[model samples]
Target: MERRTDRVMPPRYLASVNKVIVGLHRLGVPLPMQALTVPGRKSGVLRSTPVTPYEVDGRRYVVAGYAKSDWAKNARAAGRGELTRGRHRERVRLVALPVEERGRILREFPARVPRGVTMFLKAGTVANASPEAFAAAADRCAVFRIEPLD
Candidate 1:
């Protein structure tokens, strides 16, 4: 398979799919997906994107398959966002995980969110979808710990 750079914009079809997923999530569908809404770093307008949360022990995390994606940059600047799934919504603080601390969490990503592995592979974030591959790509991928706010 050919490798694609992360700097490449996501395919146009993904925008349509994201709209559908976000729409479904807003309608209270009980899917394993959530809509993450955060302010754009420069635009300041709120942006929503579908994300799969990965849990390890008691902690929840969201990973950016493309490290430099807009959402990742926005989340880093905004520091907080809203996580919504079905009818449930909660404010969350997204703390970026250091590269050194990302390996263990990424090692479980393939098993915990197998469906998401394809994005990483297609984006050239990892060589393969194996746990080891994800782990090895820690520095290239962005990870955020999800902390709930009262």
Candidate 2:
């Protein structure tokens, strides 16, 4: 059994894992994965992606580890999206943080999600582990604060 991880794993491998996770999520199985669906900016069709939404200070957030990736762009365009976990689906509106605030959040990632740091480090999204390094790298990534759309 192989684990699907951002570091060193092929894109196809992670895509496969994401597919399986999305299926299970639809089936009402509880998992750490969040199956996010948003309308594509260009096509206007719904686009789906898997992400680990984390919490900080009681607010949920999603980091664009790859920086302006499709999901992030779609999310920006759509403004609102669905976040599914098991049988639960919540409508969320993404609020992009300012560059200064985003820089602060980026510095927190290394301490809070070290594995993510390693992954992003390898992907060149995160240049270094130092606070200054992450701060500098922050403007390159999109950090969104997710709020449940009631």
Candidate 3:
């Protein structure tokens, strides 16, 4: 495993990411890029950001590359958020997994998904830990199950 010494997605790139996601979504084209919209816990205004959603065993999830990131915290507090890809939009509620269960998922996370764990590694959340080490690294990140709101 290689760690990125530089920050993952610098400010300028991140600033433009949401716009790109919106454009692709409006075109009704599905891509790995998606947007998550959640209300601010304090300001109460909707905040949206670009994220890559990963699926495991028919379940969809978004892992916080930085465990304590704003989006993760806000989503937890709001309890519900919207995920949009192309023209498909799903209102979802987040069910947080306890640490014990998280470990199980985390252990298998690196191999199961494409984006999350590697991004964390680039961001230096974890060093060059072996694939087997990702399970323990799971405790340092937040994994949320995206439950569609009916």
Best by TM-score: 1
lDDT of 2 by residue, 71-124 (tens): 888888788899988888899999878788887777777776665666565655
Better of 1 and 3 by TM-score: 1
Could you say which candidate leads in lDDT? 1
The 10 consecutive residues of candidate 2 with the worst lDDT sum are 1-10
Better of 1 and 2 by TM-score: 1
Q: Please report, in order, the local distance difference test score of every candidate based on alpha carbons.
A: 0.87, 0.75, 0.71
Quote each prediction's TM-score.
0.90, 0.80, 0.77
lDDT of 2: 0.75
What TM value does model 1 have? 0.90
Record all residue pairs in model 3 with backbone atoms less than 3 Å apart, i.e. clashing: none
> What 10-residue stretch in candidate 3 is worst by lDDT?
2-11
Clashes within 3 Å, all models in order: 0, 0, 0
Candidate 1 lDDT (Cα, whole model)?
0.87
Worst 10 residues of 1 by lDDT: 1-10
